[model samples]
Target: MWAFLHRFASPPHFYRLSGRMAPWLGWACLGTMLGGLYGGLVAAPPDYQQGESYRIIFVHVPSAWMSLFIYVVMAGASAVALVWRMKLAEVVAVASAPVGASFTFLALVTGSLWGKPMWGTYWVWDARLTSELILLFLYFGVIGLHSAIEDRRTASRAAGLFAIIGVVNIPIIHFSVEWWSTLHQGPTVTKLSAPSIHLSMLVPLLLMAVAFKLFYVTVLLMRARCEVLERERNAGWVRALIAREGSE
Candidate 1:
């Protein structure tokens, strides 16, 4: 088990694995996203109350879920890097930030657009909204900090510390609707009983969530490969890997 882990932990091994995995992940993500989009926008029935406005849930909900999920992943990676001193994990954490941030921004914007039509307002200080906005800021902070430092290791450590600390916000953002009386709606898909939303709406929502996750994995692998190459430039294996990659 340790041998397997050690082999995979080597930068060259990870780089080669990512190369093989990326295309498959990318194709799967594209297929899933296209199907989910069609299902959500065309097939899913409009809400009786919110009418067409609820259609935004297809994008908003999935992105929101991804924002929190990706952060947890980043934090977990950062924790591993810190504990095990794994440069690959740190690179992954850094690579994942921007993608997750873009998703978070999409969620915020879509949520605002959806809200304006239904709630008659584009912005609010509600707990869920506020916490989510803060999440976007957290992503920005990590990215910004990384860029500001010239030293790669220093930047990684700084961003890693911040990411680990900011993870506390994820749960707060998730449970904000329940913890306090807020304008945002409570849980629909998550409950002991059956989902509050109907199966038609639920199906598309789940599909989009899965699509977003797959997309993240595809992009993360791509970016992590680049990161590994840059970091391991001096290594003999990296030079050989580059030659092999170029020939292929």
Candidate 2:
């Protein structure tokens, strides 16, 4: 077990493994996204109250969920790099930032679009919204800090620390709607009494979430491969890998 684990930890081995994983993940993501969209947009019934407007939740909720999920993943990667001094871990955390931030931005924009019709306003200072906004800032800060530092090792370490420290905000962002009375709605799918939403709605929401997760995995592997190449540029295997890729 230890031998297998150590062998996999080697950069060259991991790089090769990740390359093989990427295409599978990509196809899976594409398939899941198609299925989920079909289920959400066409198959799901309209909400009794919100009517067609509730359809937006299919996109809005999943993007928002991804925004939060990716940040946690980035934070976990950052922690691994900081603690174990893993270069690959740092690369993963760095690579994940922009993707996570983009998702966060998508969430905010979609939420705003969904909000206008429901709340009669495009913006609000509600707990959930405000906390999510702050999450975007955190993503920005991590990315900016990583770029600002001249030394890659130092930069990664610094960013990793920031990511770990900033993790506190995640819980606050998650529970804010419940912790304090706010305009934002409380837990719908996460409720203990059973999901507050019906199966028709729930199925789509879950499907979208699965789609988003698959999408993230596909993108992350691509980014990770890029990162591996860049970081391992001077290595013999990298040159061979590049030559092979170029030939193809």
Candidate 3:
């Protein structure tokens, strides 16, 4: 098992394996997103109160979910990298920062757009909103810290520590609506009880969540492959591969 894990963790092996998996992940992402959009927009009945504006949930909710989800992934990867000194984990942690940041930004924008109709304003310093904004700045700090350093390993470790510290905010953001009196609504689809949402709406929301996760994997692999090449460029294997590709 150790041998297998060591082999799997090697940059070349991961590159090849991720290359094989990315296409499938990309296709799955495309299919699910299309289905989710169609189902949410065309099939699901409009909310009795909010009407068509609620359709933004299809995008907003999923993006919000992804923002938190990807940060958790980064935090976990960073932990592994710091503890085990695993280069692959470091790469994954760093590669995920930009993607996670983008998701966080999207969530903020969509949430603001959503707030205009529901809250009668485009912005507010609600608990969840404020915590989420902090999360975005956390992502930026990780990214900027990673880039500001010259030694890649040192940078990853530094950024990884930053990521680990920021994880305290995850639960805070998730439960903010409950912990404080926020304008944001409480849980509808994710809770201890059966989801409060109807099947038609729930299905698309779940589908969009899956699609976003797959999208992250597809992009993460692409970014990791590039990272691997950059980190390995001076190695003999990389030189040989580069020569072979050039010949072909």
Candidate 4:
């Protein structure tokens, strides 16, 4: 398994494989996303308390989940890059930053929209909200720090170190509601016991979550492949790949 991973992690091979896989991932993302949207918006019944406003959960909850989940992925990849000096891990870490930030921004916006009716306000410095806000800034810091330096290797190491250190906040974001008296609602879908959500609602939420994960991987592969080409522009394989493209 390790040998296979080491082989697959080669820049040229990963680029080729990811290019072939992207279309399939795109189709899957589209199908799952459509199903989730239809289920969330059309089929599922409204919440007794929140009504139509609750529909935003289909987007907000998934974005919020991805916001945290992607950071952990970045931090893990960063650790690998830092410890093993893996170029692909470094690329994955840097590539994930922007996508993670976008999701965090979406989560914050949707949460505010949902909060308006539920909390009688658009924003608050609650534990989860504040931690999530910090998470966005963390993503920004990684992207900015990486770009600030001209040397790609040096930049990735610096950014990877930053990502590893910033991982302390992930658990804080996940457990904020339980750790403090926050305005954000506690987890209903991920509790240890049976989910509090109805079957109708839970199914769509799960589908949306799966779609988000697929979307992230699809985008990450696309971004990472481009990053690889830029990093390997002078390599023989890259030149050969360019020749092939030109011939076609």
Q: Give the residue spans of candidate 3 off by over 4 A.
A: none
Candidate 1: worst-modelled 10 consecutive residues by lDDT: 185-194
Ranking by lDDT: 4, 3, 1, 2
Give the Å error, residue 195, model 3: 1.2
**1-248 in candidate 1: lDDT tens per residue?**
98888888788889888899999999998899998999899999989898877989988999998999999999899889889898888998999999989999999999999999889899999999999999999999999999999988889899999999999999899899999999998988876788999889888899999999999999999999888888889999988867888999
Candidate 2, 161-181: lDDT as tens digits: 988888998999889988999
**Residue pair clashes in candidate 4:** none
Q: Rank candidates, TM-score, best first.
A: 4, 3, 1, 2
Question: What's model 1's overall lDDT?
Answer: 0.91
Per-residue accuracy of model 3 over 30-132 as CA lDDT, tens digit each: 9999999999999999998898898888888889888999999999999999999999999999999999999999999998998898779998899999999
Candidate 4 or 1, higher lDDT? 4
Count of residue pairs whose backbone atoms collide, per candidate: 0, 0, 0, 0
Give lDDT per model, in order.
0.91, 0.87, 0.94, 0.95
Model 3 misses residue 84 by how many Å? 0.8
- Cα displacement (angstroms), candidate 4, residue 243, comes to 2.0
What is residue 28's positional error in candidate 3, in angstroms?
Answer: 0.7
Better of 2 and 3 by TM-score: 3
TM-score of every candidate relative to the true structure: 0.95, 0.95, 0.98, 0.98
Compared with the true structure, the alpha-carbon lDDT of candidate 4 equals 0.95
Where does the lowest 10-residue lDDT sum fall in candidate 3? 183-192
